[model samples]
Target: MDKGIAKMAFLHLSPPSSSSSFLLNSSIDSIYPKRLFHLSSNQHNRDASLQLPSYSSNQGSRIPAQWRIGVSFFVPFLDRSSEIESLKQQLLDAIAPLDRGADATPEDQQLVDQIASKLEAKNKVKEPLKSNLLNGKWELLYTTSMSVIQSERPKILRPNGKIYQAINLDTLRAQNIETWPFFNQATANLVPLNQRRVAVKFDSFKIAGVIPIKARGSGRGQLEITYLDEELRISRGNQGNLFIVGMVDPFYRVPV
Candidate 1:
């Protein structure tokens, strides 16, 4: 395959606008039709009681002007474009071998270390952690984390196909699905270890729609977030794997 075409194939698997929820639900229906029906029936009663609030045009106007002004000064601002770009480049270099379905070289391992160092430095600066910031869809650009990467194991780290992650803040759960050339799915429970760390316990893993691989013990492992903002996230796994993720179609509730 041509390099450009191969790269594109590896990165995006599904249509740009396809919802992860739709895909997941479809899989659930196929795998456990009876269970899904039962869940839907149970949810109907709950849905009827939970009415959505009506939007009011005057809602914003009700906020006191003085209060709004006072809050503005407390907002945090960070511009790390230069640093982010540097990290992105390093990640690209580190995963180049994998992109071609080749094994990572010693040099690639070195680049991974460099990326980890940069993430650690960024994590040292305290930044507020908000679930809203984490809830949404994200594309897996590059990762050394084995939890996400499964056995079809490219000798080189070429992560071809589309890998997407959907996080539900309300439920404190995360779902990941990949498709096209590679097919895998996993669900995890997100536990906040601290401001900059999270313990992701993998609940299950499924390959090619086969039986789910139930996680043994507490979960798969954990991840230490080094950097998180509107557009990017960098994390390190307990097993020394590095993860670099970028937003898919990020829509922030507040300005970053």
Candidate 2:
């Protein structure tokens, strides 16, 4: 079975946000798509809506050199399934205490450390990530960062709640949607710091049914893509937070 293609078949992209902006790279202008606007809501009694960016069908064909290094390692390692699942379970166990509003015990910290160690050992690519691999929606399964995990609160503590990230590779835009019974979303522009790291500059934040608030000044942070492939992604935030994500339905190709 082609698990890689099977994995891709299960991922999909979310509808682009209406008020989002793109941070395009100069080299790919010829293939870049235009931005589109549509009416949705009025802010402060004035007509307003989000400005969504459009992407072309052929954009994936224009893979840049920096991304090639990462893409070259995209093949799945089916033999490592056991190790992957074990690490994932360990990560969940490590973060469980934090989810309950208690500090992580020494044992829990050790598990987290183990997971990090395994990721670092397995990660072969030491360069910037391929944008195509990061495109589309991802469902957050676990996190080691208490802050982001705690943000889910009682909802995540309960069953049937989760977080989803919608990343638009064509425009370098990303949206993090946390659904814990209710939705809290944050939109940001992704700036590539290098082959392995990207900076996230938050633009707006909003709770379900509330008007989005513009983020003040610059609230930028970095994320290192420790592991990425068709089925899974592992990223570490600048603050040492770890995130484990899986692809969502309706996938696309990762530029080769």
Candidate 3:
């Protein structure tokens, strides 16, 4: 069951290092065991896609500037790029402390989804399958797939190193790797579903980066590239898990 879900979704860009402290506080909570962060409060956040309206009250409550949700909320003249960048930072910060979502709650997942959906709405890349940006070694940042995180197992028993996925659209090949503990990996041939989606059909698995096993005929799944750019890529799995991975090595090649 763990191995089955591990193959769900994969891709992303590095999160911006600097985010508004207030924004981070509003969207995420303090970290707990297993690298889990509880969702204490998210009142300030409104859907980033919607034009957030100002609220007035007899009590005169104040909304943080980050959550104001208007032209002033972002740069002028509908420059969505800046807005997208801001939300992107927020998304990264929200998950940075969650340790690849080993223990993310449903609320935490919802927050990630809400922000990701907003970014998907303004995806800069119209056709991710053909984009050069899609070719690289992407560091797994956050995922709703617990199989990759191995949340049910103890941290010492789980792969404690960086998770990565590399692809070469030129060859129509994709590969996923875990860096430490066990360098478990898998390779797949991509069958394009459209300009923005593909079916990941596994060809082989590398146990600890060595022993190879032929993939079963059933080892295939649907993955849709929902958002993409030179620095970032967002995707969804057939199991409905969201994936965010940061580009780590643009020059990484899928081993032949």
Candidate 4:
């Protein structure tokens, strides 16, 4: 799939609230469908009788006694599976920090679960994935050397002072899917949830951003990156370290 198409589908979440303002009017004839109106209690006065007018094929009037003529509006929320999924993932990310670590207690879990339930209800949740099924790791794609160190922290002033921002794609996927399931589900087939995996097929054709650079502890850094032209995925272990075994010929070079 085209990366642009996939990206758009992957992020479409909620419909605009203003869309509800559109009005629908239909004729009161057999050839034309009559628009149904929901009657509010305030609209009906003490001496008013709710009347509904209907027309036959011959344009004849048919009325029922004490008929209530009002509009009952129902918003059609359809084909939004992908958007919902995206929203679900966002929610997960927000709550992940609170629920992480060995110090987290049952109370934290309970709070997370309760908040999750509320988010699910708001988005009309569908299928839920097991949270702990897969191991999680951050992928070091492209990091800016000019790292933003907090003002309060001590600055390690050295010529080789490099800044690195480690990004966790797996965590991003999990967070977006968990929080905004509605949005993601709507666009799943367009982008595909499986595509979320950092597989070579997607990496070679998709990722957009800066080049991937590496900094070794020895103070020597290799800036081998193929940005814009294509994306690359580094094989990783549980600790987020790159796993390189066997012959290092074409694999050692920057991604094509």
> Which predicted model would earn the best lDDT?
3
Give residue 22's lDDT in candidate 2 (0 to 100).
Answer: 17
Clashes of each: 10, 16, 2, 43
List lDDT for all candidates, in order: 0.47, 0.49, 0.65, 0.21
Over 1-256, each residue of candidate 4 has an lDDT whose tens digit, in order, gives: 1122112211111224311110000011222122111112122112222234444645423333334242111112322433333433333333334212112245644554444444334432121122221122111111111111111223322111111111222332211111111111110111123322221111211111222222112211111111100011122211221211111111121222
Better of 1 and 2 by TM-score: 2
For residue 226, model 2's alpha carbon misses the true position, in angstroms, by 0.9
Candidate 2 — which residues are off by over 4 angstroms?
Answer: 1-104, 124-128, 151-160, 250-256
On TM-score, the candidate that comes out on top is 3
lDDT of 1 by residue, 161-253 (tens): 556666665676766666664465666666777876655655665655354666545333455557665555665555555566656544322
The TM-score that candidate 1 achieves is: 0.54
- lDDT-wise, the better of 2 and 4 is 2
On lDDT, the stronger of 1 and 4 is: 1
Could you arrange the candidates by lDDT from highest to lowest? 3, 2, 1, 4
C-alpha TM-scores of all predictions: 0.54, 0.56, 0.72, 0.19
Model 2 vs truth, CA RMSD: 18.2
Using TM-score as the yardstick, the better of models 2 and 3 is: 3
The residue-level lDDT of candidate 1 at 248 comes to: 56
Please identify model 3 stretches exceeding 4 Å from their true place. 2-5, 8-78
Candidate structures ordered by TM-score, highest first: 3, 2, 1, 4
